[model samples]
Target: MRVLMVSWEFPPVVVGGLGRHVHALSRELAAAGHDVVVLSRAPAGTDADTHPSSDGTVDGVRVLRVAEDPPHLEFGTDMVAWTLAMGHGLLRHALTSLLPGWRPDVVHAHDWLVAHPAIALADVLGVPLVATLHATEAGRHSGWLPGPLNRQVHSTEWWLAQRADEVITCSSAMRAEVSALHDLDAGAIHVVHNGIDLRRWRSRATAPAPAGTGPRLVYFGRLEYEKGVQDLIAALPRIRRRHPGTRLLVAGTGTQQEMLGTRVAEHRVRRSVEFLGHLPDAELTALLRAADAVVLPSRYEPFGIVALEAAAVGATLVASTAGGLGEVVRDGETGLGFEPGDVPGIADAVDRALSDPRAARRRARAARARLRTDFAWPTIAARTAEIYAAARPGPPQNLPRPKIPTGNLFDRTP
Candidate 1:
């Protein structure tokens, strides 16, 4: 089977977890004896997209990168619009004009950023399209959004999901949300769950979860509002009352870092909290392993890839039960769960993991076993490949190229 995947992000030049996910899936698909190609947006000099500028290959998977020339677009001057236009042009130029002769059976796209190109290319090439909705606006909003913009984003999401021949989401909870929110048929949405490369992660876990000589509790991911970083911050003072020297390691960066820093200062748990900022994969795995427990207090999540990573690193987890995190981290068996906004609940769960070494070990074992078996790359790759084959009927039709404009090659208003 020939597979073409479109994603806004890919590894080595990652903006978030999406990049790693796309990269992992593509490599896995290649390993499964399929011709896999990934279409992503990257800087011209980025490692995944070296000198040739337009297209390249990594680990047997063809990667096409469109260097976003921000100054070129004639549309809205807003940053978001410019980004959307850049991505749209990249897809049109790469798929329709530059890579005309190239066609594949499956067009697998991840998230809305790649929607315009994936949908258009699938139609132009007469290929089936599969969509992976990593997260939704509602999920990201944590039930706060209201009015026109929210509705517009929601409607766009539904249209994109409806366009796909198959829908793949990261968690069982996400599947349910898609079915309910987007009016998708229950049979159409499948739960693949995000996977981690255990060999890379577990090896780094040799550092152990940082338990301040005894046990460490960690909350590592993007430092932002929707991420519930505030709740985690609030929980710290209460937690310190129970267990002094119970250090909290907060990893990753975001727009709210300064604001979060202010909150951390207010609590003055500054000494108790270790703001490690952004950690590389090796460092992250080591941190997760060094800690007694891992925590993701997201108000909403499509799937907690970090939770999967923590589990892979053999760390017990305490996560918000709002989204797919609940599905992956079993409440009592693998990890503990807490209400989304409940600071005390989250704090208590963290404290439990810190104090109960035996229970934490058991949870770690359960999490590790589950991640190794169900969410391993090979298993996930096989499942995704099956979706690709199911969506792709056969050889693509010999499609005619769009008449490129004398000026901008990506002008596809027709």
Candidate 2:
């Protein structure tokens, strides 16, 4: 089977997990004897050997970086313009035979950023379009499109869903949310859990807690309000009361870092919490391995890729039952769960893990085993390939270029 994947993020220029997700999935698909081609934005000063102007292959998968020229426009306007520019690049590539005897059977898109090119190319090629909604603007904004930017993003997401032949989400929770928001049939959406490379972790030696150090509670992710890191901060004093020697490690940096720092100072738990901003992979893995329990108190999570990483590193999880994190961390089974933004609940969960290290270790072991077998990349790749195979081709009708709405967000007259 031949596959065409469109995404804005890729290797050496990853903004978040989406880039790594595409890189891993494409490589696995290529390894499985399927022809895979990726169309992604080429970052400035991209290495010529790895990311060429016309064509290149990364781990046996062909990758073409669509060059984008900077336009003198507002940030939002430039974003939309760049998206359409990348779409035009894809159009030229599709019309010409750059690769010998290679045509896409399916076009898989990652997010709304690449919707224009992916939908148009799929329609022109008469192939099925499969789109994975990693996260939705509605979900991110707490179940509402609050402003013009939010509404514009939500509109594009809805439009992309309508154009795609099949839609894929990272978890069942996300599928339900998408269905409720878009009024789509529940059966039409498929859930594919995020995966990780365990071998990279298995080779590392588990970092042990420093001599006489207290139980370490680690929170590693974007330090945003929706990420619920503040809830963890608020819960720290209580957690310390239960275990006086408890220490907290806040990893990763975001817009809320300054506010979070202020909260730590106001709470007067400055000595107990260490804000380690942006750790290297080695340091991150070591922290995970050394952590007594990892806390994820996300107010909204389409899927918690970091939860999987913590679990794979044999770290116990005390996560909120928000969106897809619930699917990943079962309450009292794989890991412990609490209500989102419940400071008391987060404190209680952390206390339980610290008090019962033996049980927490058992749960972490169970989680690691599950990740290795159930959420492995090869397994995930095979499942995604099956979805591609199952996607029926659409009519060979060349679609007109998608026009950005000028008035209403949904392109409908009010």
Best candidate according to TM-score: 2
Worst 10 residues of 1 by lDDT: 405-414
Score candidate 2 by TM-score against the native: 0.90
lDDT of 1 by residue, 98-132 (tens): 45676788788888767778877787778888999
Model 2: how far is 330 from its true place, Å? 1.3
Residue 287 CA displacement from its true place in model 1, Å: 1.8
State the displacement of the C-alpha of residue 276, model 1, in Å, after optimal TM-score superposition: 1.6
Model 2: per-residue lDDT, tens digit, 85-185? 66666666655744356778899999998888888788777889999999988777676566667767777788787778899999998898777666578
Lowest lDDT block of 10, candidate 2? 405-414
lDDT at 23 for candidate 1? 90
lDDT of each: 0.76, 0.83
